[model samples]
Target chain A: MPERVARRTWPVHAVLVVGALVMVAPLVWEFLTSVKSFGESVRVPPTILPGTWDWSNYTKVFHSIPFGEQLLNTVLMTAGRTAGQLLLCSMAAYAFARLAFPGRDVIFMLFLSVLMVPSQLFLIPQYQIMQELGWLNSLQALIVPGVFSAFGTFLLRQFFLSLPKDLEEAAGLDGANPLRIYWHIMLPLARPGLVALGILTVLWSWNDLMWPLVVNNDPEQMTLSAGLATLKGEHFTDYPVLMAGSLLATLPVIVVFIVMQRRVLEGIAFTGSKG
Target chain B: MSNRWWKVLAAATVVVSAAACGGGGSGSDGGPVTLTYAIWDKDQQPAMEKIAQEYTKAHPNVTVKVQLTANKEYWTKLQTAVTGGSAPDVFWMNGPRIGLYAAQGVLQPLDEQISAAGADTAAYPKSLVDLYTFEGKKYGLPKDYDTIGLWYNKTLFDAAGVKHPDATWTWDDLKAAAAKLTDPAKGQYGIAAPADSQANYYNTIFQAGGTVISDDGKKSGFGDPATIEGLKFWVDLIKAGSSPTVQQMSDTEPTQLFSSGKVAMYYGGSWEANGFAKNADLTGKVDVAPLPKGKKQAVVIHGLANVAYAKSKNPEEAADFAVFASGKQAQRIQAEAGAVISAYQGTQDTWVKAHPQFNLQAFIDQVPNSVPLPRSKNTSAWTKHAEDLLLKAWTGEKDVADAAKELAKAVDEELGKEK
Candidate 1:
């Protein structure tokens, strides 16, 4: 068995290394292209690396609009969405897991149905809701519609339900209220799930284009992704600068992913087996 | 790590709550004078800002705030905002949605405003000015007008030994030349037969003397023999290796094909002239030709109009700005900069001078033969259905005759619902 495991390990490592390189190709190209001068990037047959590095693309991003403020806006929006979703999803999950409620299955199923519907169908009605709330062209317009996600609720619910009830029963006997039990015992236990959810939320919210582009037309409130689109006019192609802007926009997420790599992996591993 | 997460979470909550509480900053003006001016292009933001400043210069109390959004998103957002009573006071109106938005009463009737402003309606092209007129009331001022023309790469034509496109050229002459020039194996194409309607087929359809929509705008013209013939030219061109596949062409707009020197000639819009003029490789190597003849010479005429949003708190200020924006001074600023083909007569020469090379005058001449884009109550919703069905036809998913019949039925259904 040990010899078979040894024999399999080499191919697995080789496969993983190859898979890892494939995943990083776009990032590598984006970084290399970002460093290239606009003239070099558009050349025929395309250079693998820039002959001369130009940092002006990053500076141009700032010059084009109030990019710094927009960056701050995107960060705030992503963070707001992540925290709100984690708290709301976990709380709802705990309720469905521990507490008995009337028509709970029916309500949960209704929320799950939202996941199956095409997002485009909800766009018009969602825009109407934002306008009614007087949040059009505001940060709330970007953050609020996404705050309560059906996917997050459904996902976290499964995690909550699968947790051993004995652990919570012991906490309950210690005179912990349901809320206290949720905060101290349940949430810490669900840390890996919460981290996984948070990372996913940040990534989705940061890369989101359609809704933010629709809701926040005001330059002041526009997110990084939408703001990056205006870099090209109807003509006058500038591939290098566009690549640079894209890399800058993605930097924060890449940083977050790197920091939370362990927890995210553990969460994935746990979910794979349990699922 | 946990502390970091908590800190980030706390910081984010504070920012979102702060923004939510900002209360739109409540336009410093003490009175009820708030105006919203919607624009589809953020590229023109500076120009609009200047117009707003001039308006505010005269009327100290009126403040005009610019609301700019991308094209498709703007209309979708506008529909919802209008329904919810938060539509901008003054917005950019296009021919397609004018009737729908107006019929829904989401837009204020500009009949009084037009007469009040004493705007010279005669200075605008008759066909274009008439596009915004329904039931004898003007809904918008023609901000800028463009016509479809042939933009060609002189270097490619020279290499292919094809002569320049001229006023006397016919459709058959173009096909023979394009076919001879195209070499698909070499990644080269002769003409870009894009499936774009306004710039590509609309001219051909109009030239063939077939209207896209019926007289009452209640039926589809796709079943018309001339319309189907017009559609076939594009598909036939793709099959003959005279053009790229619809999928390949759609990946890159045809103008990019011309810029990359892969295509010899492009049937592009006059609006693209400014963008093309700025391309260094294309600067001296490009030129224009009049739309080749079919049954008669025809070109698609498109323009944007300044519209007033009904939900605006300050309608008067918004109207004043709209009128001023379409006035001679602003029009000349855009024309002289060669940014657009100004709608106002006599000021068009400045646009010609904006780009010294190429026959900009060709556009000016074709303006008389231009036909306005077809419109109904809800132009976009109806137009998009035809666009998608037609795209499928281009991709060989459906036969041309069958696709035309389907498009005709679908367009008829949408037009029927409009009634």
Candidate 2:
């Protein structure tokens, strides 16, 4: 019986190992390509391992743009956006979850429809609004547009509805107001929801390029992803330099992912909820 | 209390945000007045920074921030920036986009400033200067001009026992050389005959006595026999195996191949000579000559221009910088560096000597036959469509003649919509 079970599990282990390797191979290849000289990178049949690594590629990334500043700008903007969405969306979600109001569903529907509509349709009009606000080339422009996320509100609301009512009722009986119950009782139960929302929001904000490129032109104002765009032009050569720049720009986000892997994986696990 | 929420949010947002969107510079306790100087070229960043430093030399009161956006996004971003009132005080403008921006009344016309500076428009090639004009007013000043030519690897010619390209070479002569020099066993090819635009195919269309669009910017003439003939020269090379397969050449840039000494001939812009010279492999080996003749010897003269934003608070300062940028002092610096053939006419000789090994004079000599690069009210939209269709032909998915007609029809339809 033990031998038969072992035979069955071995194939599954092999399959998972193969899958993991396939997923990681591109990153390994990108790192390897970043260090190769431009000429060697494109030679026929391609090199699996670079014979020599060029350290100048790291220096070249800084020359390409203000890499250190861009990384910091991206981090600050991303953290602010993620935290803002988590707070604001939870408030909106609470209003919808436990409170009663007329036309609530209709307002929720309107917000929800934004997620369905293609983002390109909103870009032009939103840009005009930013112009009017005189917030162009500002981090506020990157952070403001997606602050009150419908997806976050909807996700948090579902989580709120799914929570047990006993604690909130007990808190209410203890003479705590609804706001106090919400802060002290319901919010603690919504930890997983906030974690999920925060992870998605941060990833979205960090990787976003198009809107940032539209709003922010100065290197100091640009996020890492948008700043990486300067490496490409009407005519783009120097693919190694480009790849090196890209890898360097992406490293911070990758580091974030590593530090938050457990929560990120859990967030990804629940991504099918909207379906 | 409800109305006060907006004020509260505004204050909170201001407090939370790290990136400032301040418009004006410091006064007493305040920050300096900010000015955005935008451009689209990353290759020219060092030069732009030097120029920005020069501008800051005269005006320490204003801080000129250098901004860059990539090609398609530059225009898209500029459109947004202008509409948003956050456009750069000074920004780079391509020839075709000049009309679109000017028509929208977003660009600050520099006609008065040009005259004030006593700058001679005659010093610029007329074809290029004409692009910056709208309703007898010029919106841009030429910063540089790049003319395309036949760039060949001399070591490859020597190895293949072929004569060097000269003014005397004709279309038939080019074919003979390509045929002899091509050696398939070694991954060596004779020509980089990829069907392309701006750099590759446009030259042939002009050489064959065919115009891309009419002088009045009406219908596309790509369906003309001469234009089709010009395109066929490329198709024929691939069919004869003188050029690499489209698959083999797709991701590999031709200039790279020439500099690597992998290809015998490459048609490239004079702007690329610096890039070629920088490559250690081809330093003394690569050379330039006049493009092979079809009906008449013609080349395309193209460049970028710097323009000022109309929304700028310091319009006079911005205008002064734009005009000063196109002046001979700046032009001379650009010329001696060999980064570009500066728009100032007399400064080109210095540019030629900068790359001593290459026959750099050939590019300068072709200047007279050079015409304005094809431009329209919305050129990229039409040009991009043509590229996608031609790419189909290039991969041998569509017949060249059939694709040519389809391209011409699309251009005609696009032009009609513009009308």
Q: What TM-score does prediction 1 earn?
A: 0.89
DockQ of each: 0.37, 0.47
Worst 10 residues of 1 chain A by lDDT: A230-239
Clash pairs detected, candidate 1? B89-B309
lDDT of 2 by residue, A151-249 (tens): 899999999999988988898899999787777777778988888898888878888889988877668878888887788754435657778888887
lDDT assessment of candidate 1: 0.78
* Cα lDDT computed for each candidate against the true fold: 0.78, 0.80
- Report the error of model 2 at residue B104, Å: 1.8
Alpha-carbon TM-score of each model against the true structure? 0.89, 0.91
Per-residue alpha-carbon lDDT of model 1 for B125-170, expressed as tens digits? 9987888877677778888888888888888888889888899999
Q: For candidate 2, what is the recovered fraction of reference interface contacts?
A: 0.43
Error of 1 at B102 (Å): 1.3
